[model samples]
Target: MKRKIGWVLAAALLVLLAAGGCAPKTPTAKKKPTPVKTEQKAETVPTYRVVADNNLDKFKQTHGQYRTINYDPQDDLVSLLPESLAKLKKYPQTTTVRAYVTDWQQASVQMGSKPMTVLTVQVQKVLTGKKQLAKQEIRLILPGGFQPYGQYDKGSIYHDNTIPDDEPVLTQNNQIPIPTIGSTIVLPMRKAAQYPAKEYLAWLKAAKLTTAYVPADAHSMIWRCNPQTKKLTTNNPLREKELTKWAGQGNQTWATQYKRLTAELEKQL
Candidate 1:
C-alpha cells in the first residue's frame, strides 16, 4: 500500500509539471495596447435637381423632408398655389363648390355638423367631342358641400367684373348658410373609352346639349341648346392648340395655357 501511494504521488507531480510547461507563455506580462478605433464619417446625402424625376410616390415620400423641392418652370402652377389649392389644381377643369350654411342657435344639428363642408370632387367630361377631338360633357361633383373657410365671414371681395366683389364674406358667426358652388368640375374626353357615342348622345339630350359647332379638328362639338338657354361647350385642348397655339416654340406653352383658355372659351358656351 505504501509503495502504491508513493507511485500515485509521483504520477500526480509529473502531470502538474507537464501542465506547467505546456501553459501559455506570459511575455513580460505586457498589456495589449488598446485598439484605436478610427471614427467613420457618415455618408453624404444627394443634392436635389429641378427635374428630380419625382413621381407620385417620391413626391409623397419627400414632401416634408428637410430638402426643398425644385420645380420646373413649366410647372408654375405648383409654386403659385397653397397646399390645398395645389391639391385642387392637380385635377383639370375641376371646380370646387365653396359656400356655407348655418342656423340661429345650435351650431351643429344632428343632420349636420358645421355650417358647411368642403368636398374633393371628381369632374370629368363624359362625352365625345367634334370628331372626337374634345369631350363636350362636364360633370359637376359635390361629394358633400362647400368647405367652410372660417367661423365669421370677413366680407366679400370682388373676384371678377362678372360678379360684385362686395358680397359679404361669410364668417362662422352669421346664421347664414352657403352652398358649395363648384369646387371640382371637369370635362374629360376619356369618357368615350367607357361609353360609346350613342350612350353620350343620349346623355347629351338628357342634359340638354347640342352638337352645333362641330369643328373639323375637334373631338366633340359646342352647341347652343335653347331649352335652358344652356350653351354647352366641348373641352378640347388639342383643338384649342390647333386654333390658338402660335408658331414654333409656343407649342409647349399652349399645353400649359390650354386650361385657362379652355375655361374662357367655355364662357362662349
Candidate 2:
C-alpha cells in the first residue's frame, strides 16, 4: 500500500509541473524617469539711446564727464504754439526748406546744461523765406538733440522744475532722434545767436561752418518728409499739435502759408 501511495504522489507532482510549463508568462513594467524642469530668461529691448561722454568724444574732444540732467522742456502745445507764433513774427527770416542732413558737429556752447549738436543740412529747396538758399548747405542749432547732459542748480533760471521722476537720467537727452545722415527733412528756421558773436564766430571757424541757424519755433517745426508720399511729419508729439493748431487757426495768412509750404514740400525729392 505504501509503494502505491508514493507512485500516485509522484504522478500528481509531474502533472502539476507540466501544467506550469504550458501557461504564458506575465510581462514586468519598467519604471519611467521623472522629467526635468528648465527655466528660460527673457530678453530686454532698448527703448532709447544712452549717450555718454565717450560718444561725444567721437565727434569732438569733451572737457568734462557726462552728467545726468533734467532736460525735459515745457514743450506742451499751449506753451509751444504761442511761443512759436511769437518767434515766427519776431524773426520774419524764418524760412521753410527741404534739406538733407549731410553731417553734424557738437558745438562748444551749452543749450541750458548741454552742448548743442549742430546739424549740417544741404538745402534741396526753399519752400518759404529766402529763395537764394536753394542748393546751399547750412547749420542749425536745435535744443533737443544728442548732447552731453548736465543740470542747473536749484532756483537757477535753466533748472527744469517739472522733470518727471520716471524720466530716464542719462548723459544725453534726445527726445527725438538726431536726424540721421543722408535723411531728408523739411525744416523751418531763423538766423539766431547760439552764443555771443565772438564765441559763435570761433565755433563756426573751428567747425568750418559759415553761419548757424535755429528752429523758428520749437522742435515740432522740424519735420521728416516721407520720400514716397511727400507728406511731412514730426516725431515730437507736442510740436505736432502745435503744427496742427497753427494750421487750423482762423488766421488766413498762416493757413495760406501752411498750404503753400505743404504744396512745396510735396514737389521736392
- Best-performing candidate as measured by lDDT: 2
- Give the C-alpha lDDT of model 2: 0.59
lDDT of 1 by residue, 1-269 (tens): 99999999999999999999999987797799999999898875322111122322353453332211111113112122112323433544333221111111111211133232222122222222223232222222111122222212235252234323333222221111212222122232222123347754554344333321111111322221222332333333334445454534566554344444344434433
lDDT of each: 0.31, 0.59
- List runs of model 1 lying over 4 Å from the truth: 1-125, 128-150, 153-186, 189-269
RMSD after CA superposition, every candidate? 24.4, 14.4
Task: Predict model 1's lDDT versus the native.
Answer: 0.31
Evaluated with TM-score, which candidate comes out highest?
2
